[model samples]
Target: MTATGGAAEAGQGPDQDPIRRSYDTVAQEYADRIGDELAGKPLDRALLTALLEQLTDPRAPVADLGCGPGHVTGWLADHGARAVGIDLSPAMVELARRDHPSAEFREGDLRGLPAVDGEFGGAVALYSLIHLPPAEHRAVLTEVARTLRPGAPLLLAFHRGSEARHLTDWWGHQVDVTFHFLDPDAVTADLTAAGFTLRAHLDRAPYPHEAETDRSYLLAVRS
Candidate 1:
C-alpha cells in the first residue's frame, strides 16, 4: 500500500491496479488472519454447501472468484468439486498455490476472467464484490455469467448497505482501498440484467467477531 494515486487518477484499469496492489501489500497478514474464516461461519458453510448441491456436475470446475488465500476453494475441492481459485493479486495467488496444492490457483480479474466461455459449472464470490464500485456491478456480473454454463449457479456475498468506506490504514499497513456496501435489490436487478435467474436472497446480522455491517447473500442461476 505504497502511495499510488487513485486508480482513476493514475489512468490504470482495475486489473493490476491500486486495489490489487493494496491487497498484495497486506495479502500475507490478511491470509493469516482470515484464512480459516469459514470455520466460524456456519451460515456461510451452509450456503456454500447449497451451492455445491445445485451444481449439475459435482466434479465440474468451480471458479472461486477473488479468492484470497484459497481457503474457500480448498474447501470446495475437499467437498468434491473441481475448485479453482482466481485473484487479482499475484501475491495472493502465490500464497493460495502454496497453501492449497490440491486445488488450482491463478491470477485473474473479475471484469475479464482467465477462462473460456461457459467453462464453469458454478462460481462463488464471497465478500469479493464489495471491492467494485456499484456502477460496475452489472458488467462484472455479466462477465461472470459469460463464464458459467447454462443454469450454472452463482453464490454472491457482500456487505449490505448503501455506503462506501475507504481504508488508509489496515493492520499497520498504509493501504488505499474502498469497500462499497451494496443493496440486495439493486444487486438482484443487476443479476437479472446480466442473464441470471435469482433463486434466493438472504441477509443476516453480523456474527460476533465479524464486521458490524449486515451481510447479503444471493444465489442465482445463469440463464
Candidate 2:
C-alpha cells in the first residue's frame, strides 16, 4: 500500500539502515529533482518568510536541518541570516556545497544532530522527519529544542494522512527506500512534549509530485 500518516499506531517499527543506504546512493538524483523544484518556488522559503516575520530579529542563526541541496539554506543566507544546512547523505551535502557556495552544508544525521547547543535562533526540517518511527518524534523534537536557544522558532514540514504504511521511496531508479508519514496532531503533541508551543499548523497545497491528499506543514516555537 502507498505510505500514509495517521494517529498513533500500535505496531510501528524502528528506523533501519537500509533506508539510509538507499537514500545515500540516490542522494544526487534526489537532490537534483528536489533542488530543481524547490529552487523554483521553495516551500521552506515561504514558511520561513512567515516565521521570520514573527521573529524579533531575522539576522539570528537559523539551521536548515535535512536541508537537501541547501535550497532553503541558500535562501536564509541570501536574506542575511546566519544559515547552516545539515543532511545525512554525503552526496547531498556535496551537491549542496557545490551549488550553494555561500551556505554551509554539513553531513550529519538528524536523529542525532551535531549542532552546538542553544546556538541557533531557528530551525527547519522539510520532509526530513518522515522516516523516523512515531515514537522517536518526541526525541527528535527534543533534540531540535536542545540546539536552539529558548524561544527559538522552528518549522517542520511533512506529509500528513491517517496511518503508518510503509512503501518504497518512489523517486524512480528502482531504489528501495522507505519513510513513515506523520499525523499533524501527533506531531504537534510530540513538539509540545519536547517543550515547544504551537504557533501555526497548516495543510498546504501539494507540491508538483506530492499527491494532493498528502501534503501538509507545521510551524512551532520553543517555549
Candidate 3:
C-alpha cells in the first residue's frame, strides 16, 4: 500500500492521464473478448447479490464505476438494482453501451463523477481501483461518498498483493498502465477516512480456472 514510482505534479493525480489512456486503448478488444466474463464467475455473482441486499429497495440507483464492458452493470439490472455503468474510458463506455443495451453507461473519472451528491443508493467498483495508485484512492472514495446517499452500500473488488504491476502491453496491443495490488487493512483505512463504515472485507486465491493473482472484496456503507 505504500506509494511507489512517482506522484503526479500539484493539482493533478492518477485519474487525469494513464488509466484513461490505457483503458480507452484496450476497450474494444477487452469488450469483444472478456465482456461475458461474469457468466463464468460464481463468487463475483454472489458478492454482487450481497451488494444489492444492502439496499432497502431494488429500484434505487446503483452505479458500476469503472464498469469496463458493462457486464456487471447488466447483471445488476437483471438481479434488481437500477444500474448505470461509468468508466474513465470513452471507448469502454461506447462498447458498454453497445454491448449491454439493457443498462446505461457513461465515461467519466472516479475522482469526479457526473452524479450529484446523494444521487445513488449503491455502487460497485469491480477490479477498477487496481489501476489507481494509493495516493489517488482516498480522493476517489471521497467522491464515492458524495455520490451515494447516506447508509448506501458500495462493493469493491481488487487484486490482493504487496507490490504494484506495470503493463506495457495487453491483448496484443501496446498500452501503458499500472495495476496496484492492495492490502485489505490499507484499503479499509482509506475507506474509513473517506466517511465510510466498513461492513465486510474478504480475500481469496484466484479461481483455479480464472486469471492468476489473489482477489479481495470490500463492502462499505456511506456514513
C-alpha TM-scores of all predictions: 0.93, 0.84, 0.90
lDDT of 1 by residue, 48-154 (tens): 99999999977679998888778888999998899988887777888889998889987777777888999899999887777777888898889889999998999
RMSD of each: 4.1, 5.0, 4.5
Q: Lowest summed lDDT over 10 consecutive residues: which window, candidate 1?
A: 1-10
lDDT of 1 at 170: 82
Across residues 1-223, which tens digit of lDDT does each residue of candidate 3 receive?
Answer: 0011110000125545666666667777777667777777888888888888889556679998878777788889888678988877667778778877888876666777878998898988877677667877888789889999889999888888888878788778787777778888888999999999999888888776666988888999998
Query: Is 1 or 2 the stronger prediction by lDDT?
Result: 1
Q: What value of lDDT does candidate 2 attain over all alpha carbons? A: 0.68
Clashes of 3: 0
lDDT of each: 0.81, 0.68, 0.75
| Clash counts for all predictions | 0, 3, 0
Model 2, 34-121: lDDT tens per residue? 6555554465568888776665556667888877667777877887778888776556667779988888877666556777788788
Model 1: residues >4 Å from true position, as ranges?
1-16
